[model samples]
Target: MTVIAVTGHLHLTDPTVHLVRAALGRLLAGHPAAALTGVSCLAPGADALFADAVLAAGGALVAVIPSPAYRDTLDAGYTAEFDRLRHAAAEVLVLPFDTPDADAYEAANTELLRRADLLVAVWDGLPGNGRGGTAHMVAAARRAGIPVEVVWPEGAGRRPAPPA
Candidate 1:
């Protein structure tokens, strides 16, 4: 079985979302449906997109929630998508944390890498803003010898980082 994990920005533009979906579809095309498994955190942007593609491709999905209160911390706009992905996951593993903090997110990222044979990074070819971001995870995956496929389709750009 091919187990793929996803890491990316949470705030993506509409066009970027479509591009990401198409890119994921292309990446998953060769793998047999039953032999494919996608791992994700079900976060708003790339994570959610990857999970959707996995399901559409008749592949199993495994969700690694960052914390017990992860749902509570989601933006209202993303609540529906998050709930849908969580419900559709073949397996849901919530880390041992009460809130969605940096530590919890890092732990979740670690678990994702541990379970994945490959990582699909929807990145902008830039450094991550902080510790648990997509760039950090991509670097970690590479350091651990996990193959990472960076997907940044043409014209895709990131939303401005939130003020610190």
Candidate 2:
């Protein structure tokens, strides 16, 4: 089976979500359902999109949560989707962290790389927000000798950052 993991932005523009989802679906369609497995942290944007595509493709989903508290830390608007995907996961691995912070996220991303045969990144080729972001995961996957497929569809764009 091919194990694919995803890392990406959490705040994509509305239109970008549709674009990414379609791109991911097309990508996953290349793999036979019986030989496909997807691992994701299920973060709001791209991660959730990837998970949905995996399920839609008849692939197994293994969710790696950074912490038990991670879901609680998601924005209220995304909590329901998070819960739905989490419940649908074939397996859920919760790291031993009480809080959802940078350290926990880094660890979770590490685990994702460790388990994946290939890393599917939904990055925009921009500098990441911070440690454990998409760029960091892509670098980690490369350093570990895993193949990476970046999916940033044409015309895709991120939502503008909210005022500080």
lDDT for each residue of candidate 2 in 1-164, tens digit (9 for 90 to 100) = 99999999878999999999999999999999999999999998899999999999999999999999998888888899998999999999999999988899999999999899999999998888788889988888999999999999999998875564
Candidate 1, which segments miss by more than 4 Å at Cα? Answer: 162-164
Per-prediction TM-score: 0.97, 0.96
Candidate 1, residue 69: Cα displacement in angstroms equals 0.5
Candidate 1's residue-wise lDDT over 25-128, tens digit each?
99999799999999999998899999999999999999999998999888788898899999999999999998888899899999999999999999997888
The local lDDT score (0 to 100) that residue 151 gets in candidate 2 is 96
Model 2 misplacement above 4 A: none
